[model samples]
Target: MQCRIISIGNELLIGDTVNTNASWLGNVLTEVGIDVTHIYTIGDDLATMKDILSEALSATDLIITTGGLGPTHDDITKRAVTELFDCELVLEDSVLDFIKKVFKKRNIPFSKSNYHQAEVPDCCEVLFNTHGTAPGMWFDRGSVKLAVLPGVPHEMKHLVNEKVIPKVRAINGDTEFRRSHYITTAGIGESTLSDEVVGSLVDVLPEHVSVAYLPSPQGTRIRISAYGSSDDEIDERIAPVRDHIKQKAEKYIIGEGKDLNLAKAVGDLLVEHEMLISVAESCTGGYLANAITDVPGSSRYLMGGLVAYANQVKENQLGVSTDDLNSHGAVSKPVALQMAKGVAKQLGADIGVSTTGIAGPSGGTEEKPVGTVWIGFWNQDEHFAIKAHFTNDRQINKERSGAVALEMVRRSIMGIKEMPYGFKKYPA
Candidate 1:
């Protein structure tokens, strides 16, 4: 089945409001074996809404629309839909009562415009929305189904998951269900992971199996998806691709699951090894520590961390030599090495990580330009620092540095010899 999502709001086109509802619906619909072909974002003009709705209904099996469903005067989705279907607006007494009760419970006066929230086209069925006053409407025109939802994200999600999906499943009971399994990897770029690490998924995947690489600031996640009549059938179809990816990129692969973060992966590994870790951050400003502690139960393996932003703090707290700070200007290998070792000794942890860099649009020298980052790792047996050049964006540099630091911990604990991005590891 094919789906089309229509976002009706001038705010979206003008960039005042983001159309997150379309992306959410697309993901939800695709997981149920429905292919989302196109997304339409238009103003609240009644003619444009009607035209787009008509076109979408004719071309797609399912059409879902969000926005323009409020008590305000400019709200026009219900009117446009009614005009398209050549139907009259009818007040739903139950919906009206619910809206009144909601206003009463909130101790707000219900106005005449509030009645518009309860009115729907007589041709459509009301999908009761307990989350808000605006009821979602469902229209079935033989082969095509149209769901009209409110602009509020939480309300839209509630209706789609609770009402629209069940209706879609009931209608397409015989359709094959599709599911995706995610394999997440850290410390690798998307191109390297795609072309070098896990090469030619087409060759390894069986029939009806496909792969997609989703890259973010944290890491790259490979989505292995398959469609089948049963769970076993889907698993059998997806196993070969999953296994091949694991075999080729085992060193870089952090874990499986779309929601997995690199910090969480590192925290899990530290716990497994019964190791405690501390951080001394300079350019990243404790971002690495924040990322690590973002994981639940991180206290099991996380020791305290230090920001060490100023030169005095680095010298006094982390015990970096003032000579090195003056000679190397705080963004070099020697300072990074001392910071890691000092943090470990101060916190009495088994492992320590440190980040020092010029993460900025300014404060760059001829020797050490912006995004020149030094990540240091220290343990009883191993001590080294890796030099990496990232982006000019300050926030991006911070995120990438934190990711590299966590990935360094993961790779070191797993005994992977290769450095992140295959950059050479220098002895501290």
Candidate 2:
């Protein structure tokens, strides 16, 4: 089935709020074998909503809209939808009762706005939202299946999972199903991964089975997609290409699953090797530590971390050399190395990792530019630091630095000698 997402809000257009709803909906629909062809982001204007929604309803079999469902007068998605279908707004008693009870529990009076929220177009089926006040509406207008959901991410997600999915599945009856496997990789550029490591998929990939390289701030996710009558058939069809890619990119591959990340993969390795790890973060400001601890059961291998941002903290807490700080500056390889070794010693960890960098829109020198990062690693066998140059964007630099650190840790644990992206290691 074909789908189109209409994200309604001025906030999205004006860059105040991101259109995450459309992307989330697209992912959900695509997983269920629907091809999401168009995404429209419009303001809360009634005429624009009606026009765009009308065009969308005509364009696709399944039309999903988010936002503009609120108590305020600026919210006009419901009104526009009602106008398009030539239906009068009518209050749903069950919906009103639910809202009133919710308000009573919160000790707030049920006002006219709340009553207005309970009203839905007379022609459409009311998709009662148990979590929020705004009622989701489903319209079956001629050949189109339209579902209007709340713009709030959690609420929209809830409604989509509960109300919309079942109806979609029932309507989907015996249609083509899609199965996708996500192979995540870090510390490698997308071009190098595709051109050098994995190479072309033209010969290995079957007619419909394909791969998509999705690059992110931290890493790359290669999604292998296939369509078949059943998931089993799809998996069977996708096996050849998936296995080939896996074999080719064995060392670079973090792990399987759509959500597998560098930290999680490294955490698994630490557990398997019966080792504990600690971090001393500078420019990344505990980002590396946060990533590591974000994984479930991280306490098993993590010995906590120190955000040694200041030179004094690095000297005092992480036990960096005061002479090294004076001679080589805070973002130097020696400082990074000292921080790693000191953290391991201080925390009594089997391994320690440290990051020092200039993640900035400013504070760059002629010799040491912005995005210059030194990632240090220390263990019983080896201790080394790698210098890398990332983008000027502070957030991206921080993320990339963390990713590089984790990938190197993964490689080191796995006994691979080459640093991530073939960066030269500066060892003391």
Candidate 3:
């Protein structure tokens, strides 16, 4: 089924709040085999809401709207829906009781304005909202169905999962439609990955499946979508193609589906192998360690880290030799490797990762320019380091350095001999 999401709020247009509801709804609908074709965000103007709603009903099988359901005068979604359906507004006693009980529990006085929340169109069925006072409204007009949900995220999610989806399934019934899978890869550019995949596996992909390349600063995401098939059939069709793509990009492919973070992926690998890790950070300022520790149960593998931004700290804390810093500089490969080895030995960890760079709006020279980063990793048996020259802004360079550090650590643990793209690797 094709669906369109309408987010109504002046706050969204003015940048006072983000329209996360639309993105959430789109993802949820896609998982349930529904295609979300468009998302509209508009102010709380009555005429605009009415026109958009009318237009959506004409073109889409399902229309989901969020916001403008409060008791304020600007909240006009209920009135707009009533006029569109040509139905009278009727107050629901059960909803009114629930609202009163909510206010009574909090010892707050309930006013007549709150009664507006209890009013629903005569022709619509109310979808009860257990999370909030404003219940959702469900309307059926011909073959199109419209569900009006609260703008609050938690309230909307509760209604969609508990009420709206079940209603949709009941009306449409179970049918084998389509399935989609995602393959996430990092440490490679999107254009390069696409070029590699297009040449070999594009034609071999099943007729029912289509591939899309989604690129971001983190990495490229390859989506394999299969339409008009059951779950088993879609899996059977995608299996060989997925395998071929994996083989082509095995070194670059870090994780699958929603597990895209290179740091988190490495953290999982460390936990699975029962390996411990420590880090020494310079320009990235402990960002690599922060990313690793963000995953739950990471304490099992992450030992700790030191943000040695100052030269004295690098020398005193991480044991980077003062001679190396004075001669080769802090961002040099030799210094980075020493920092990794020092931290691993100090913390007594199985693995150590370190990042040193000049991530800068300033701090560039003819020899070592800005975005010059050296990432290093050390294990008991081996040590390795790589130099990367990124040209983005300071914050982006730092983030990229952290991601690259995690990827290096992952390769080091997996016993990969060299870095991808012909980059030079320092030995232990």
Candidate 4:
């Protein structure tokens, strides 16, 4: 089914609040085999809400709106919907009773403003909101279905999962829908990966299955969507193509779907293999260690880390040679390798990861300009260093360095020999 999402709030338009509702709803609809064609964000103005709703109903099979459902006067979603459907606002006694009981249990005074929350369009079906006071409303206009949900994330999620989705499924009945699987890849540029996939695999993929490349600063994700077939049929059709793509991009492919964080992926690999890791960070300032330990049960694998920001700390803590630092600078590959191997040996860990660089708005030279990062990983036998020259903002450069360090750890754990470009091996 085709769907359109409308997020209603003046705060969203003014950047006072994030419109996370649209992203969440779009993902939910897509999971249920519905195609979200457009997303509209409108201020709390009644005319804008009405116009967007009218346009959405005419164009899409399902119209979902979020926000502006509170008891305040500026909350005009229900009023606009009622006007559009030619219905009158009726106070629901049951909802009012629930609200009163909730307030009574909490020992709080229930005001007249709270009563306005129970007022709904007379023609629409009320969907109970167990988490909050605002109730969801569902209206059927000809062949199109419209659902109005509260802006609160928790309340909207509960209503959609418990009530809205079941109703949508019942309406959809036995209509066939497509299913897609996402494979996330990193360490390769989007244009390069796209060129390779389109040139090689386009002709081999079946008519029922297709691939789409989604790019962000982190990496590119490949989504394999299958249409007009049963689940088993779709799997059968896409399995070979999926396998072929995996073979083509095996080195770059990290994890599946939204499961592609480098730290988490590497941590899982370490846990599976039963290994411990330590870190020594410079320019990244313990970001690599923080990312690794952010995953639950990371204590099992992540021993600890040190942020050796000053050159003296690097010499004292990680044992980086002062002579080396003075000769080749702190961001050099030799210093990176020494930092990695020294930390692993000192902490008695199976692996050590390190990052040293100038993630800079300043502190750059003519040869080594801003965003010069050297990531290092050390196993028992040897150390490896990768030099990355990123041109993004400082925060993004740090993030990229952390991700690449974790990827190096993953590669080491998997016994992958060759490192990517800008990486070199050093003897133990």
**What order do candidates take by TM-score, descending?**
2, 1, 4, 3
Comparing candidate 1 with candidate 2, which one achieves the higher TM-score?
Answer: 2
Kindly list the per-residue Cα lDDT of model 4 for residues 368-401, writing each as its tens digit. 9999988888886666787888864888888888
Candidate 4 to truth, TM: 0.90
- Give the whole-model CA lDDT for all candidates, comma-separated: 0.91, 0.91, 0.86, 0.84
Candidate 2 residue 127 C-alpha distance from true site, Å: 1.0
Q: Which candidate is the best by TM-score?
A: 2
Instruction: Provide backbone clash counts, one per model.
Output: 0, 0, 0, 0
Q: Can you write out model 2's per-residue Cα lDDT over 1-428, one digit (the tens) per residue?
A: 89989999899999999888888888888878899999999888888988988788778899999999989888888889888889899989999999999999999988898789998999999998998999899998768899999999998999999999899989999888787899998878899999999998888889778899999877788999998888788988889988999999988888899878888999999999999999999999989988988999999999989999999999999889999999999999999999999999999999999999999989999888999999999999999999999999999999999999888889888899989888999987
What is candidate 3's local distance difference test score?
0.86
Q: State which candidate, 2 or 4, has the greater lDDT.
A: 2
- lDDT measured at residue 426 in model 3 versus the true structure, 0 to 100: 77
Which of the numbered candidates is closest to the native, going by highest lDDT?
1
Q: Which is superior by TM-score, 1 or 4?
A: 1
Q: Order candidates by lDDT, high to low.
A: 1, 2, 3, 4
For candidate 3, lDDT tens digit of each residue in 284-378?
98778888888888899988898989989988988889999999999998888999998998898998888999999799998989989998888
What lDDT is reached at residue 100 by model 4?
A: 92
Superior candidate under lDDT, 3 versus 4: 3
Clash pairs (backbone) in predicted model 1: none
User: Residues 1-428, candidate 1, lDDT per residue (tens digit)?
Assistant: 89999998999999999889898888889888889999999998999998898889889899999999999978999999988999999999999999999999999999999987899899999999999999999998999999999989999999999999999999889789889999999888999999987888767878889899999878899999999988899999999999999999988889998779899888888999999999999999978888888899999999899999999999999899999988877898999999999999999999999999999899888788899999999999889999989989999999999998888888889989888878788886
Number of the candidate with higher lDDT, 1 or 4: 1
